[model samples]
Target: MIFETERLIVREWRDTPDDLDRVFEIYRHDEVTRWIGMEEPLKSPDEARTVMTRWQARYEKNEHKYGPWAMEIKASGIVAGTVLLGPLPEPSDGSEGRGEIEVGWHLHPDSWGHGYATEAARGALELAFGRYEVPEVYAVAYPTNERSIAVMQRLGMSPRGLTTRWYGREAQCYVTLPRQRAASN
Candidate 1:
């Protein structure tokens, strides 16, 4: 496990078939994919396998406390969903990693309405700000995804208004800066 919150265990995902099957269950749910900008659920296990492989590889390639991590509830040992902290993909405008780190969460619909999303996200934000010293972290969501937007606000992010800065489509951007104390003269 990478880190542990009071109610969750965050860990790197493996590419084994059982783990792949577990992850597929989360990604293949329409309700979960809907908010993630996917119009349809992931259609096949191969598709999920590919995603799992990619995430595992990305985690291995990084030394920073970043990439997609599985959120397993401690008491029940259920894999709730995922929490991610990483550089945003290039926008349609084609700018590369202009130092924008994104924080996001995806929970199975079964896991919704619980505090899991907020708790897992708080762990990711703490890792970004407290450990890596990233100047700030951002979150972007479809304008209509109120549930996700609510999570961002609960994380103390201020809405920066609608923007096309990260994803190709227009999205609501939210940001939070690290509380670094000023140096005394």
Candidate 2:
């Protein structure tokens, strides 16, 4: 899927070497990956390639679990990070439609404070809610991940009164779209 923003174009992984390299650069950053609860900053180029291979395979295996898209800047074509809207492998509850579409994003350390994640995420959400017609979207961030939590709040996602421990870290649960108070602008 492809979605556009004023400054960035968010779409599924194309698997070009350059695209793989850009995503690896961001994923390999110790600071950035850790913020997202990734234990290992992305390693070898070959490993990145393997990931892409799997991503492509998922498109056929399960459309709900597609490849994470590379986030590219419109002006320079530089990949800033990744934006993914896919089904949660497992959901907080185990029932029908429990694994609703989830929205997630990651970016290079240099891209921080630039609103790129939020920008790309807005585009992804439009596809999730508008194109796919998902009634709601969720985002979960480690309690220690203040930056991610802040972004979730900016997207108008609110606490859903749930929590979980993931990868040995505490996480906060939040949901957005069709809120009782008001919809996002």
C-alpha-based local distance difference test score of model 2: 0.75
Candidate 1, position 98, lDDT: 76
In model 1, the number of clashes is 0
| Stretches of candidate 1 exceeding 4 Å from the true structure | 94-97, 180-185
**Candidate 2: tens digits of C-alpha lDDT, residues 1-185:** 38789999877777788878876777788888776766687788877787778878877677644447778888988888888777765533433446566788888887888899899888888777776777888788877778888888888888875465223445787888755214667
Residue-by-residue lDDT tens digits, candidate 1, 1-185: 77789999998877777678878899999878987877688888888888887787787677636779889999988889999999888776666567789999998888988899889888888788777888988999999999999998788788899987666788999988876211110
Model 2, position 131, has a per-residue lDDT of: 66
lDDT of 2 at 78: 86
Q: Candidate 2: which pairs clash?
A: none
